[model samples]
Target: MPTPSRIEHDAFGPVEIPSDRYWGAQTQRALGLFEIGEERFPAALIRAFGLQKYAAARANAQCGVLAPELASAIEKAAIELREGRWDDHFPLTIWQTGSGTQTNMNANEVIANRANQLLGQPLGTKTPVHPNDHVNRSQSSNDSFPTVMHVAAAIEVNGRLRPALDQLRSALAERSQAFADVLKVARTHLMDAVPMTMGQTFGTFAHQVSNALARMDDALPRLLVLPQGGTAAGTGLNAPAGFDGFFCATLSEVTGLPFVPSPHKFEGMAAHDALVELSGALNTIATSLLKIAIDIRFLASGPRCGLGELRIPDDGLTSSIMPGKRNPTIAEVLVQACFQVIGNHQTITIANASGNFELNVAKPVLVYNLLQSLRVLADSASVFARRCVRGIDVDREQLTTNVERSLLAVTALNPILGYDRVAQITATALRDRVTPRAAAIALGFLDGDEYDRLVQHPVNCLINYPTVNRAAGA
Candidate 1:
């Protein structure tokens, strides 16, 4: 038979918890009470929690509040957690207490158990490294949870998201330069309107992503201001006088993130406006990515029926019945990922507004959505860069054909021939379904020699307008 369950008692009542589990009464209680979702916190968050506890233990020990041995044990255990050991031990879901109190306790209990084991103490014994007093000496769940959110988000954006975006931008820039001279018909309102180089179009995509990355950087300062010192209600109630400063400095040292104590702990604890701003940046990025992905799909729409300006990478998955159908699989995946990020942004926005007087009751959902958005964007950006943008092949034949076929090419002749003449040429070209060059000559708008001289090169008409000496011609 299984080992008999152990009874743990908290303020509320006694509950039977698994003896083998590292979590204590509060976490056990939460596990039993909240079965809302299967979505647990990711390893990044767990590592962040470890970092927070480790910094706290080190700072508390340095401040002479925690015993040296206990602090050392907690620090070691936190390191293990930070290095991703025993990640599965953190079993609390993201649907726990709004303040993330349960997950915080979950971290506290796991660290306490591991530390106790290191000192030859048995599991569930909260002595030597008591979860609340020693491990969480100068911090509260209110502050620690939010601090970890910032820590995790900062690390991800700096280490993963930014680099991923940079790679994607580089890929797009490479394509832009490679296709610099590949002219194509420009579309406005989904109709042929003008002419532009493929390079110019891709360059705009690169700039949009670059701007989004800058926005993420701009929001970093706000995220770096942490709420670690704000214990119960942002008043530093049970924490020592200099605990905030020491904690921030120690955490910064530990994580390499420039974390500073929030001057107004109330704002940090009560409102997640910094996260909201970051989410807004992420939303903008998703919007840009959505546009980029959709544009790719549109350009690679059909080899026979639609604008086949691009050739998508053949992912080897052909349609079962259609014989040969190469889908824009990578672009579609990026598009779907961006859609999720956008929806997650809406969730974050609504959750951010749920902040009450001195505390926000939407911490779990806000952090959940924030992390999800970051992960999705980073992954999507990488895939898009490597599989989509890098492998993209320009359909030069289609591009050239469309450029010559477009009626808007007639606009370049306006400066030399006058707007009335150009407009008449365009109308006739559209109605007769002929090239503007053919239409102009057919309509007797210009002599064959003059028309030939003016429309000497289609590319020059689109990009480099010839300096037509109308006075000489007239």
Candidate 2:
């Protein structure tokens, strides 16, 4: 038997919507027309719509455009939507209309129907509250969609992504302090270069994360500026004079973020450059994280064979074929996550560029990719900081061995014995497979006492004193 559904009318005639659904004809029509992808808009975006609708109703009421009782009903319903009570009501895919008009209509219909239900009327009444006229009063899909986009993106970046990054940076800084006294051989172009504390290396990773945080701060202001007053075509056609200010004030009060009206509503509705800028910041973060993860994996490469200067935390995961093999699983996971964020950034860039004269048709896909990148990066960063960076252990013995065996330690002798002499000493050490100190002594360039004083001393060679003393057999 066919499930019971009621008829709802729109400009395109009647649509048979399910009686149990809070959505009306427009949302029902959208469900049939846009079936392109299974990727529905995320709950964050839906909640943002709820917040936008609630703010719009209150703003319209303040402007004397909507009745207080109607606004009260819409506000109650919109709050329920924002609090995720009606998430199922918004089932449109991200592949819908470029302006997100369908999803915007979906919000309007659900709120309007639910509002009527609260006003002692059944669903699909469109009586006390109409989706277009009352629920979406003083707003257009073009402006409203982008306004919520900014709201959702700003909230996620500040609340989720920033804290995760801070956690990772804190973990790295703690490790840097712990490793401050340990000397290790630095690498350039995958070859041993010179002596440096392991702390300095981890400090570099922390600085990269700090820079990413700075970029996020720089991009946040643009996200806070909204263009909600621009009713269709970037003109405040049917909206009241102070509706934009009222909406922004109400939105900021609810969201706890300082949202402001866009000075030029045309740019906000026409282009998603702010979101693209945030995506670029996310891309930089991905790039930084990828570098740090790859470096950690490389340093923790092998227990007995490769340059195992760092030890990865064992999570009981091992290779199936190779016995007793441990993997840098967390670092590898972070690396892959960063790769996805990078790819998402490219998608956002292309989508932003696809905008036309008055409005961008790629809003849904653009915001979808941006939010995915934010969520993945935030989750991956938190996991990496907890499971990997905090638990990482340095192999002091291996670091010492590699440092003592490196021919580049001769770099320290350059100022004392000119570059030519140091180069000759390095060549001899490589050829004879002897330590640089032994090569210098055998080349008659320096006696044992002199070589010890010139190259073995921590101050002269820039090595940590206690660690280098043991490595040099002092």
Candidate 3:
């Protein structure tokens, strides 16, 4: 076995616990147990947690509940955690027994131990910075965990997903304008229906993204409804009278986020409707991604036997047995990501609603689901957009050929030839492998003048590709 690297420091004095005691068990067990994997706590989440602790200290200082020196000490310890400086000290298991009591206690113990060092005292001492008294004086896991969730979600979305959306929109805009002259057959229920420019298809995608962004903007404010003022049971029992308002104002200033004081602290703490609402916005984004992924998959279906409207980049080996088979793996991954995001939304809803009147007992699950959903969405959206959507190349030849071969182009002739005559024109053209006008004239549907007038007077009348191209070119 390896020598014990147990942390000897305490919050107040020298370490008094033995090797067998659980007082220092966190450091020993956490380092030993989670050794199987190399994953550490997320740097972004740690930063946000540190900012929360810092903001909490400042907020408490306004009421003078947390003294200046102690508040400063908390800030120092949180800074260490944020910088990952105390990797050895943060040995508490990520999956703790008390529903994130370990993470919360990890911060408390770590901060308290460090603050005692600042005061020339042993670790675990509460004289300078009592982890619960001064550090978490006016806060609860009920409030802090969700607060960090919002902070991280907002940061990720603003930093990553929004930029990706803009990239996709811009790429589609350029593709739309580029494909304006290329005609393609639009299908309804996988059957040829109408003629449309491929550019028009891209324009529709752009509009859908624009609407998703609007929904995102509208849903984010609900997350700002926080439960910070509700200390234990939404009574402000130990907090000062005006601390809630001033705390929110100062916290907002420090974090550069708009933090609104909860008007209904009980509801905020007991119910995670805010989180559910935010997750629903993520579900919306996922739905959009799924639609876009579906479009990409359909457009790039096959090289010889499919629509093949666009070419997707082959990133890597798709199959072991098939030598030259490239797959839409990126779109598959993103679509699966969307599926999980929706599942995470449902988890949030069920977890939040399962709580009691004043506090949600499933805080760990709440943070886990919310963080997972936001992280996956923010990263996956950006990745799929830039790597897949933006890189797609249209096959103009394939698209135009498909459109030209489609018999639905004669639908515009219904006004001149009536529905029965138009159907006859399409059927005869398909059967004889000739132009619809030639087939129609052969069947005595019209004479030369009538055929010319019927096909040319109305732009929708049956016309061969060459004639249409010549007219368009002229």
Predictions in order: lDDT = 0.85, 0.89, 0.69
Against the true structure, whose TM-score is highest? Answer: 2
How much is 38 displaced in model 1, in angstroms?
1.4
Local error of candidate 3 at 228, Å? 0.3
Count of clashing residue pairs in every prediction: 0, 1, 10
Tell me the TM-score of each prediction against the true structure.
0.94, 0.95, 0.84
lDDT of 3 at 21: 25
- Candidate 1: the clashing residue pairs are none
Report the lDDT tens digits of candidate 3 across residue range 60-121: 88778878888888877777766776655444434543234556655666666677777787
**Cand. 2 TM to true fold:** 0.95
Better of 2 and 3 by lDDT: 2
- Identify the runs in model 2 with alpha carbons over 4 angstroms from their true place: 458-474
Off by over 4 Å in 1: 1-15, 447-449, 452-458, 461-474
Among the numbered candidates, top lDDT falls to 2
Please give the TM-score that candidate 1 achieves against the real structure.
0.94
Instruction: Please list all clashing residue pairs in model 2, or write none if there are none.
Output: 98-361
